[model samples]
Target: MECVWTRNGSRCGEAASRRCDRCRAVGYCSLSHQVSHRSIHKIECDRFRRQMNRADVLSDFPFTFYVEPSKVQVVSFEKRCSFLARHGVHGLGMWICECSCGSSLINFDTISFIPDWLLSSELCPCNEPSISLQGRLSSWKDYCEWRHLPLSSPAAVILHWPLTVYWAIQLATGCNLLPEIKNELRIHYLGPEKELLQLAAFGELQALFPGVRIYIDFVGPAIPDRRSDERIDLHSYALCNDTACRCKTEMVSKSQAVRMQLHAGFYHDRYGEFSK
Candidate 1:
């Protein structure tokens, strides 16, 4: 039987470097990818091997991961904490988050954000305070170490400010069950104290179910009424927070492209300074 390694809906054929003699199910295209994956794969490789040995894989059916907008929801977290009636979320709920990696668990209030459609101008209500990226990297390194994640492996960054909303949505749509599913959703909130508030359990699920397709679809482009753009750079920029502010580039900057690039770095350093 041919060995197949599928992650986050992306497929990698049997590579000499990835094959594990002990577990025939999981193989990587390169030793580095396999080595980086050992943290999670080591625990589940045995089970996956047993399944593969049974000839459970369907031939001619290439593995795939799917991401669809309907599966995700964004909620409001700030509202639930505010005392002023007008400050909190109109409808708020509490929730708890657990890392499928068995690393840690967190509890907090939650809310949901529903995209306009494939694309929409969604507002963000997070702390607009400035921070130092260098400092953030210091702390994030600790968090990653604590969680046993590869320092170089892709990791998601979540802000601590909008805890309630992020938590609520995360609970509603547990993390992705496959690597591909997990990779599709990379959302970020702007705030200091970057605390990986939520990620679709993408890494864990991918490690556990290598063959499953994971998809997280957000209502973005293709919606006739929504001017959502697949190219984030084209999205309009506006203040996400409710705070009043001028539209000056320094006082206030908006660019989907810039924001997207920052998203990855933000996870690495939750609260770091941004230079113009």
Candidate 2:
């Protein structure tokens, strides 16, 4: 038997004698090995807790609308009206949203106008605006503190914008709908907030597509920008020319040649920025 902690080429060939006290699903050769493996195990543990939490939260709610998951498709304004009418909730001041899981329908209050970005074809599974905002804000604050980055820094500036994370993932996967099933996806990030909103986005994607192999390339701090008032340049971070940075080269090597893919014909100027 061998130690079960497999991370970054770490493997304990020694005989396994101890099991995790919490899950009891893995064996470790020594107490030190079990302690060392806790970091990676925490991710899965947290995911399990979140699943339980979701179940608990939804336990008391009644299913107002029930549509077979297989029959659901992207709905338009007219289609939304039909859906509302079918559910006998038309003119009830409700907002409809599709979950990121590609199944289940969410109804929101119609008091506030939902932004196109939030209501677009691809939306978060959480569906609730307050939950989404709180999650993003908490992740942002935790990431900033963990990375020891100032709130006013360029990296912080980019990480604070959750939409940027969405754009980055879209650019990396070359898909308009995020959290899509994929064999593997690689992302190269250049900034201090390495585990900011991007981490949260990746977590969501992982939950949606459990088999996805996500590889992240952290390229340290962004290149300095002389033209901009800020010390760190946004453009340089968007498009790296340094030979050491493998973003461009990796994109070129891909079969799709995504480096040549332009977003709204402004890929070269301000590639990462999300436009209306």
Candidate 3:
């Protein structure tokens, strides 16, 4: 005669006379409790109805309620190629979904790339790639053009300086030069352009921190080492230049910001380096 449902951190153990109208198997002391439990009880009620309707006694197949599947269509292989061609994305060698907006490409591997609210809609108008595509494409194009230049070339230094400093920061302080500004912060390589790379990094840091005297180490190779009196790496606290690093390899192929955070933790504790 006691209510089967638990309520307010305790069992409803009161006398019960009302049974669930559908299953008639469970009872509740109050109508509120019954209503609150309906969402859960409906599942069991549906199962019970299914079991009752089955005519074959020997059939051991579990009862399953039929629900219509979503009608969203997956893009066909031919359509995918056409979409890629239209967008000028060639030879990526990966499966990508052209977001319904026709403005961005979404790699299938990034499962969480689509937000939950967007997932519920019939089509996802992913605007992130569209917004960032031009900037990234231009950056890559510039990188390719300057990539083969000698590190001492003024052109290479001017173009790839931001990226070089970004990596130096990562190696020295274990912190990424840029953090949390945008989604796509991949650093493109401009070869081994080391001329004035350290000076350029120091200048960038000084500009960012104004009045903070930063120092660069020229021993062996030119790299930003520390501020005049501070032992801490300047890159650790410097505002990320929003440029990508180039030294990153597939083994640690995470966003530059995330990878640097991991590196920072590793330097401090010596145990957090990413493992395969």
Candidate 4:
């Protein structure tokens, strides 16, 4: 594990050999660095502990991909990486950013803190709405409760997308779609490369903005030429094999929530077309 501490604009890339005794999740390259990062790390230390003690959901998967029960339950940070490595998903896309900002300067090795694999992801959940919360969302605990998923559920990895949209819309235009506001929420989702593969994930928007219809204009040059402009009425959620999954329940059945319109072109070149 890499150093868990970063001071100012600097980072300690030294191998983290010392872990926090209390949580046994976070690590440090040295004692001084650990002391330096305590104030910020203190906030999420307990969260790290809670994340470790949760039930192992991997073994419960109904599909044929059955790993050993012992392999599925990972409480150690080193073992967590090893487990992901076996599946070829050990944070391969971690620290990746597509923003126009100075994301290029971000160095993965020297990154300040390494988030627990299942917690806030590259989707950046920490960047919440600047306006009043309106009881829409307060914390991850409440969100997992509302979604009927456990804290250990690997939902945040992808759920970050819908949550990001919820935060972005509010931060930009202060559009808080409270339960009473039964309005159609339209989003111009630009630059959709990987997201196109899992379009169903955006369906979580229905839950994020309950009672409000969401129309997603997925405009990007990555769209296939054959489907340059197409409208898809997302009538249902993706099928799930697990009976315990909410997607398998009536909460998601027959739900016509998200409508998608694909436009295949660069947003800059198609600005005039989109403006119309």
Say which candidate scores most in lDDT.
Answer: 4
lDDT of 2: 0.34
Candidate 4's residue-wise lDDT over 63-168, tens digit each?
A: 1112213222242333444444453434434312322232454442333212222222222222212232346563455565555445544435445566667755
* Higher-TM-score candidate of 2 and 4: 4
Task: Estimate every model's Cα lDDT from 0 to 1.
Answer: 0.29, 0.34, 0.31, 0.52
Supply the TM-score for candidate 1. 0.22
Any runs in candidate 2 off by more than 4 Å, and if so which?
1-163, 171-181, 194-202, 208-210, 222-276
Specify the poorest-scoring 10-residue window by lDDT in model 4. Answer: 63-72
Badly placed stretches (over 4 Å) of model 3 are: 50-276
- Which pairs of residues collide in candidate 2? none
Q: What is the C-alpha RMSD of each candidate to the true structure, in Å?
A: 18.8, 20.6, 24.2, 17.0
- Output the better candidate (1/4) by lDDT: 4
Could you tell me every candidate's TM-score relative to the true structure? 0.22, 0.20, 0.18, 0.48
Decide which is better by lDDT, 2 or 3: 2
Candidate 2, 1-276: lDDT as tens digits: 457555554456578999766555457898988888787666556544543444443332221122212122223223555654453433321122222221133221112221111211111221211121222222333333333433222222122333343334543344333465357655444342223212322223322223445443333222222211122111111222233433223221122111111121111123234221
Screening candidate 4 with a backbone cut-off below 3 angstroms (N, C-alpha, C), the clashing residue pairs are none
What are the per-residue Cα lDDT tens digits for candidate 3 across 1-276?
Answer: 557565453556678869787756568888987887777567567645553444243132111111111111122223545544543432221112222333254322222111111111112111111122222212322333223222212222122344444434333233332453323322212112122222222223322222323333222111222211112232221112122422111121122212111121111112112221
lDDT of 1 by residue, 116-153 (tens): 11111121212122321222122323323333433322
Ranked by TM-score from best down, the candidates are 4, 1, 2, 3
